[model samples]
Target: MHGPVSAAWLLVALCAATGAYCLLRMRSGVEEQRLSAGGEALMGFGMAVMAVPTAVFTPPRWAWPLYAAVFGAAALRTLWAVRAAPRHLHHLVGASAMVYMALAMAVAPPGPHHAHGGIGVPLLTGVLLAYFAGYVLLAGARLVPAAGSASGGGSTAAAGIRAGAAGWGDRPELARACRLSMGIGMVTMLLTM
Candidate 1:
């Protein structure tokens, strides 16, 4: 009957725009890498937007199936990717948390699952946020000191070897930025809601 012309839809649109930009920034340069780290958080933010609306907007019969099919598929894909790219810890954690969010809502009573408010209320909301916040913080910690010197320069790469004046610290910034993006997006999503 009623389409999601609600304020929530606006949030989703904002998320989509942010997500795309994040994807792009992830490719920017060694200096922008810290920003790229935020991408995972952005992805989480996008998924949360989609989830909140679908859960709140869907009618009966379709709710469970929708949750299972969409979120489940995304989560599963992320999980598979995690195994395939075991080195990508951000992907792994982001996907795992997404799976947790899906499961959290899947069991709610029929129809407009999000209408209850309990799903996104303080408890679940806090947990969802904490996970993402921690994700961003981790990435920030990893990227600090050198900020934009992924051309090696970070403390993490200092011990290994040296490469020119930058001393391996001037590597790239995307990996680190993606990490921050994920966290920053989480804060944005949480604030928006």
Candidate 2:
């Protein structure tokens, strides 16, 4: 229940909630939205698992390899589907990050040694930070109401806002917020390592 652990748990809860919402949204048959929903669910769930406190349950030696393999498959799937849905490239990056973390943690020497490994932990951390930071910024921009639009009464802008509100009710915005939250979470986790 210390500050860092508390924050990590909060991130995990946020990710789980987002994943659940995305899965619910997938029930709707919109193909494009469904693709995004699926990616969000995967990202959320993966991050939640990654953020779990080691004290709560240290992953067994086999678990890390299994996780890496699963995420490796996910990365391949993302690459194959990237042409169909370009947003999946982001999913690929997230999955790749998971793979990197899994492998890094697996090979990392036990005990009080630094978190950096022989395989360029700093480089991996930098890449993840940049990707997540960009995602958060772009997603945040998408969530904001455009300037001079809110003031025009009954304009397309207003309609857009209404649509956004409806979308928020549907939880896409919430999912985006969760992504941003996860990005922050990942950065925090990386820094702590």
Candidate 3:
């Protein structure tokens, strides 16, 4: 992630935490949730690893290709899963983006001017940035309880408390929050790339 060490560390924390939460979400009784959570967990952890500052530890020459291979496989898996549930399409996009970033890094190792120089394709990066930005906005909007729903003692706070009352894997709000955080983390990583 060729950036300030502090920003890198922050991204690591955000991604790792989101990954851990997704791991917990795998226990969901819902098969769809389990499948989606697994992919999201992989993405979160992968992003965390990739976000590590170059000053701290420079990955070996082979590492970038390995990343690409892993994410490419993930993208394939998501593609297959999308046949059953269209929601998995997002996972496919996320995995593909990861693959793109990995290949970009492999082509051009991090340097002072890597962001503007030879890191990633400008057009593709811009597309990804737009996609994730829109996703973050849409997800954030969904998180807010509707004004009408907030009436009848079903205020946003009350709804949140009810959602939190459920078990980890069953908490829809938490799951959405986890996804939202990952979206923000992805945007941050892409910007740094």
Candidate 4:
């Protein structure tokens, strides 16, 4: 647990929890479906991180392909979200991160001419990472709860969350919880890897 393998596994747990939270919160709105798509993206990446270290974790030979699929699904969902979104930089960041993940898996050549990781220094990859990171921050700042409910009945909507009395729509606290959980998980997975 002191190195990359440990780190990767930790991220796996964090991401899995995030996915679980999304599942629980998915019952909130007409737009809840969009969040589900993003959750799937995170789950795909989490699975990829899990598969990266072991050559026989799954259909052994399909390792890279699995990663490729994760990258693709995540990228596509992000793109769709951005297209459907209302001109928000947060949406753009999420989309960029997905594209970056895909590029990191396939676009880079197998040499110094390509990125070694960390999304490259001065390229779209860097922009993607930054964007995704921003989305994570935005998402964390607002957690959509079930429609018509709020921890504090007097709460108001901010950051896409529409809180109500039935229950909290997306509230910043819930968003923060999701962020912290996934953030911890990402760190853990990266460490294991």
Name the best candidate (by TM-score).
Answer: 3
Candidate 4 Cα deviation (angstroms), residue 175:
3.2
Total clashes for model 2? 0
Candidate 2 collision pairs: none
lDDT of 2: 0.71
For lDDT, the strongest prediction is: 3
Model 3 spans > 4 angstroms off: 110-113, 116-121, 155-165
- Predicted structure 3, TM vs. truth: 0.89
What digit string (tens of lDDT, one per residue) describes model 3 on residues 1-193? Answer: 7778999999999999999999988988777788788999999999999999888888987999999999999998888888877878888989999999998888884554465464455999999999999999999999997879856867655565677755657677788888899899989988887
Candidate 3 at residue 152, lDDT?
89
User: Candidate 2, after superposition: displacement of residue 95 in Å?
Assistant: 0.8
Regions of model 2 farther than 4 Å from truth = 1-3, 112-114, 117-121, 154-172
At residue 110, give the lDDT of candidate 1.
50
Give all TM-scores, in the order shown: 0.47, 0.81, 0.89, 0.52
Look at candidate 1 and tell me the lDDT of residue 9: 59
> What lDDT tens digits, residue by residue, belong to model 2 across residues 107-158?
8765534457445558767878777777778877887867766675765634
Better of 1 and 2 by lDDT: 2
